[model samples]
Target: MPRLPAPLTLPPGHDAAGATGPDPAAARDRYRALRRRRRTETATAWAFVAPSVAVIVGLAILPVIWSLLLSFQADDLVTPSRWVGLDNYRALRQDPHFSQAVGNTLKYTAMYVPLSMLLGLGLALALNRKVRFVGLYRTLFFVPFVISATAQGVLFSFILDPQFGAANSVLHHLGISQQGFLTDPGQALLVLVAISLWSGTGFCMVVYLAALQDVPASLIEAARLDGAGRRHLLRHVVLPTLAPVNVFLLVWQLIESLQVFDLVYVTTKGGPLGSTTVVVYFVWQQAFQNFTAGYGAASAYVLAVALFVIAAGARALRRRDAGSPEGAAR
Candidate 1:
């Protein structure tokens, strides 16, 4: 077959011969086309972003607003809803159960957050040092974090069994008496808090490890030269440097501890006279067990507002407490 004729090639003189690349007129046209194409691209990008914005507003923001409105209404699970303006809030203020749940939540936070943070920091410091099987130790510590809360709860439920528990058995071996861990109303909450600390500390340890690695060795050496011992360095140099991380861990731990439901539900079912009943569990009970959707929504919105206020306060405090790098390093 005969080959087709070669397409025409432009002559060298068709364009410029100087330092400038293209003809000025052609360059201007090309620039205009590029600007137009960029405008189109920007518009397309905004179009894509708009869908996500809409989705977030629909799924998150709208539901939150509706729940806030519902909280003020007198809507029972069985009855058709009618707005009764602030009754739910008034009821919550009067409800002993709400107060009790809040108290339990606070107790859990007070117990879990400090214990978890301290233990996590200590383990991280130890693991961060150059030691044998450091990787293995880190992995072992982190394994509990990987386990599901429900699974952990179930495991602990068996272990904390008052009559035939592994823990009680070990206590007996150590010449200690059996104690009610998840059964006694007075001690049930503490057991749950302890379980939370045990499981959560490893995750916080990983965070501290990262922050510790980021701390400058030069600063550590300078402190050492200034005759600062390990404890002094930790309190003066290391702790200050890790303040941001600590604040982050604190807020997260507080929020998670406050909302603890799954483990409590699985282990105690808010039993022994509702001693381990947290705010989230209260909400869950209202929504599912009691079938009071409006009440549940109310509880959730109230908790959300409380969280917002606390988080804002914590952030402000953190900003005020934060020192300049010079101060921290010194």
Candidate 2:
């Protein structure tokens, strides 16, 4: 090779070093400009968020606070309140109706949550295959979920009427005695559960379907290649992949079932000997029907506590799973 050219000299902004030095004043000015821009952005963000925060504090947060305080007092909507701390809670502890309502809510949640999830999962698994008219099928399945709970209750009530309803007519035609579907205290709760399942399973199905789509095809194929059967694949791969969604659906359905009111309101109205009187309906009865606002508030707080506990438990479960050995292996 020929002789190499000499290295270029640093012209300025250097202190015995080849590296070019930035101007101090210009750097400070740029820093100040960035800070100003950030401040402006933060202020604009807060401005946009202020309205929503105000609405939430006024409507949701304030009402929750008010209810907590109200739970300790004696008040009708028309009357001035008297502070009778803990009395409302104590009364609720001894109330047979309240006890029954709690039991009913638990019973409903126990049955509804698992059954609906199973039904939805089964439907999702079925619909995930390569089938014609899949979109139409999905739309049809989800239609009931979009219907209001009040509408579902009304529709079911008319269909299950003991006198001249379609259900009883079918029973009659099948040579069976006409059953008191909604009117029978023994059957009313069960009927409501069935109706609720009809309307809510679609929602569960949609969520599960979405989750199933996110399942890794590579993992599934690997499982199959490793001689895993369908059952094994579902147990070891599919269900595990949908774990978060499962937890979500479980908690959501648990809360929904516990707070069920619209169906009870429109259908049996907590009638047929209060067999279908869930906790929410019971609270409404106490607050609106009996004008025992404080007592109702106390009952509602009890429910709120239960929901908080459940949410906490779910979060703990998620954390534990994330820290688990199996999770690390995955």
Candidate 3:
């Protein structure tokens, strides 16, 4: 202990404090490097999106603008050179057939959407379990959705034929008269609506099934412990969980029903006194068949606006519902 300890000394290059402060130059360099990296990432993202944006602008936006221009012009497909202002829209309002088409479209949507949703929900509820050959059942149920609408129309046309058709034959065997499925003005649209429901319900069922899978097993078990039956569980749990899916299906079905044309054209050709003629079919008739392209375009715009209003109303309802306490809890 003879020698006193030399005072501890730090190196000149090092700070006396350990890890207590940032080096400003190093931080500035890091900041600049991070900014450069972010810029590079943003540029890469835009590069990936550019092609899709270009395609959408070219195909969807350009065609919509062109159609708008055409709607204001007195132009056939052959000569789209003349301008006519709002005459086409005015003419659309005055036409009795247009009014009928509008009525038929509304009727179709009203009949089709609810029935499809109900059928789908029912089927999903019945089949949302492990069962024998469930995969096969699901496949069979979904097959119709993949079939082309035109093919479906032709198949139904033959099946609904008055003479030598299976459907009528079955009715005859059942002591029922052979009814005009597609030929009667009163029944044609209804038959089409039924067929649409049959085909579309499968898609909705699949959606519901997917949603049902996401339902909490714990909640279901609790419900069962509380002696909740199928009806009670569906009412209190499943339905609430499925509200969003139902809304989507309802809006989509309504839009699709309004735009229905292929089946009517392929099966009935809008015959039986134009009973099957929805607004879209009428638009097709005016544009392609009668050379009233401008008028047809105008009618299309009107239909688009109607769809917009319906969709907007639905969205508003959804928003209001979502803002409520019940929706928030779900």
Candidate 4:
């Protein structure tokens, strides 16, 4: 109390900001620091990702762009490529083998997508219960999916060989004629579909199983309480819950079916005739085997367009569904 000087007073936050605002110099320095920090962070992030970006561009993006260019040119890999503008694409329309390949590809996709999804869904439903060795059953089912494409082809080829296959041996034992499964052009495509279903259904089954885990048990119980039977519960409660996953599966399998090649490569090689000549196999046969690289590139581009369309459509549908009232309710 020895006559200390009075404390200087300012309005509420004015002590911190002065009468007008925070110190301009301080504010500018703070802004500069923030900008510097952000720049450093962005540079660091780019540095980390540059290698990956380079790899993707070098491998995937550049190849895609190159192939698109190749589609417009006639090149047999041996001769110098010539710019034919739309000739390669035009040739595709009149080329009988190309037409057959497209038809075969569409046929395979039509058969494979629905059948594989159906069988997979059934298996998934069956496996969605509490049972002994359920994990083992799931593992066995998924094993086929993990098997390499080459191995799958080899395994199936031996199993379905018209002459010395175990399947034929069984037919012989049963006193039935040994069917020309992979050998005959008529049965070859169908047989390929079966093999694909055998391998590809596992992936669908696993995806369905995972989706099933997310289905509302409460919804199921409520449906059952309200006089719902097995089919009704599935149709009304379970299936609706699974719509998004179903869309995903459909698009994914459609793309895969369109690009099917490896099994066709090893087993059929486009067939005894040209039966199993799917779009990808057709591309390989033309580009590498038949040495019509431009035509192959064109076919490949057609498939690429189809796949892009399907994926884009599915995405649009999903976005629309997500904006709907039902999606929000879910």
Predictions in order: lDDT: 0.87, 0.92, 0.89, 0.91
Off by over 4 Å in 2: 1-43
lDDT of 4 by residue, 1-330 (tens): 599899977754365546655677878999999999999999999999999999999999999999999999989999899999999899889999988999999999999999999999999999999999999999999998898788988998999988889999999999998899999889999988998888899999999999999998888889888999998988988999999999999999998888888988999899888888888988988999889888899999988898889989998999999999998787
Residue 262 Cα positional deviation in candidate 1, in Å, after optimal superposition: 1.2
Model 2 residue-pair collision total: 0
After superposing candidate 4, which stretches have Cα over 4 Å from the reference?
1-29
The estimated TM-scores of all candidates read 0.83, 0.87, 0.84, 0.91
* Steric clash pairs (candidate 2): none
Clashes in model 4: which pairs? Answer: none
Cα lDDT of candidate 2 equals: 0.92
Q: Report the candidate with higher lDDT, 3 versus 4.
A: 4
Q: lDDT: which candidate is best?
A: 2
lDDT of 1 by residue, 1-330 (tens): 999999866654364433434578778999999999999999999899999999999999998888788777766667788887767677778888888898999998999999999999999999999899999999999899989999999999999999988999999999998899999998999888888877899999999999999999999999999999989999998998887788899999988887788998899988889898889999988878887677777888788888988799887876666565553543
Q: Could you say which candidate leads in TM-score?
A: 4
TM-score for candidate 1, residues paired by index: 0.83
Instruction: Give the Å error, residue 233, model 1.
Output: 2.4
Q: Which model, 1 or 4, shows the larger lDDT?
A: 4
> How far does residue 243 in candidate 3 sit from its true spot (Å)?
1.6
lDDT by residue (1-330, candidate 3, tens digit) is: 699989977654457774345568878999999999999999999999999999999999998999999899887788646999999999988999999999888899889888988988888887898989888887788788888789999999999998977999999999999899899998999999988977888998898889999999999999999999988998998788888888888888888888888888999888789898899999899999999889999999999999999899999989988999988988
